[model samples]
Target: MATRQTLIEFIGERYPEIFALALDHMQITGLAVLLAILLGVPVGIWITRNKKLARYIIGTANIFQTLPSLALFGLVIPFMGVGLKPAVFVLFLYALLPIIKNTYIGIESIDPAAIEAGRGMGMKNHEILFLVEIPLALPVIMGGIRISTVINIGTATIASLIGAGGLGDFIFKGISMYNNNYLLAGAIPTALLALGVDGLLGLFEYKITPKGLKLARS
Candidate 1:
């Protein structure tokens, strides 16, 4: 279509800006993801040790999920100021639940018999937790990352509202100008980014799965 060519030309003309936008999205998403992992991994380990706390941990994350993204973003602005910092913080907060919950569930769901076998072989608790349990849990944990990344991509569109500048810039610009083309530019790229990242993570998950486990699944 003529519209498609025009859009491509527009993007090519602004390729650097588009690349920057993508990088900004990646930075915001990656920062959030990294922080979530730091927080989630430890909490997941702690939950394994204190079964009673698992409910509370998951319950707290669920509470965050219930709040609207806009509302959560608004709440953080007062303490964190505005723009990319606050936006990244919001994304990080949003990611925490999935990563933490999946991390805990993945480790917990791992076969107890395998864990016993490790212990029976005289492996220390830390050794078993890191060596045996984590390997088995990698797939599930990566699933959480996939989820969080997709969510971040969609949510990053709102980043421009706070001056964080991303693909959302196109969507928001289109809105102001009432230009359908601009909105499509933003929406399409963000959607593609989400899908692309999801596929990559899915591949990573498959690769990390143990060879023996692959047969078991089959």
Candidate 2:
């Protein structure tokens, strides 16, 4: 009970700082995921047209996925230097594989007969893509985005080390000073943010998914 009260008091004292840090964390995460979606979705679609390139592209993204987050951050430091740019860039890299792979899988998994029906209806390639393919593929693509967003939220804490200034500042400070309140202050919010974003995205995924797909799943 005493510890709980202490934590509450600590949060009360540091509310402004915590709010600002949370905003910064969200900004970094949002930008990284947006960039990933923009680039990844297009590349994912493009690779579908080129199976040979798909292998190389997905393989390269897999390599980035395999790298430790800290190592990737360290590698970018010399070229991009410290702060938000590098942090976002690293997070973007981390986000790419899931978005790209899921998109590929999503589109590729569509029945060939569906594409033939669209073509039979005299739909152009782009029309078929936008109408049939994307709608069907959306849930899977959103799954990747949801995965990426959660990963970014958690990883953004480490960005504080590069002067990116997120909840991680509190976490690392807590570690250095051995302050449990500080650790809780940072860790709790990060976890909450991840869970909250994931839930919201899950809802959005359901809403955007074609009704037929939902029925099929059911």
Cα lDDT of model 1 by residue, 92-205, tens digit: 888988988898889989999999999999999999988899888888888888898899889988878888888889898989999877787788888888999899888888
Query: Which residue pairs collide in model 1, if any?
Result: none
Q: Write the per-residue lDDT of candidate 2 for residues 45-128, one digit (tens) a residue.
A: 999999889999999999988999999999999999999999999999999999999999999999999999999999999999
Where in model 1 is the C-alpha error above 4 Å?
none
Assess every candidate by TM-score: 0.94, 0.98
Residue 185 deviation, candidate 2, in Å? 0.3
**Once superposed on the true structure, which residue ranges of model 2 sit more than 4 Å away at CA?**
none
Estimate every model's Cα lDDT from 0 to 1. 0.86, 0.95
By lDDT, the best candidate is 2
Looking at model 2, residue 119 earns an lDDT score of: 100
What lDDT score goes with residue 133 in model 1? 92
Question: For candidate 2, which ten residues in a row score worst on lDDT?
Answer: 204-213
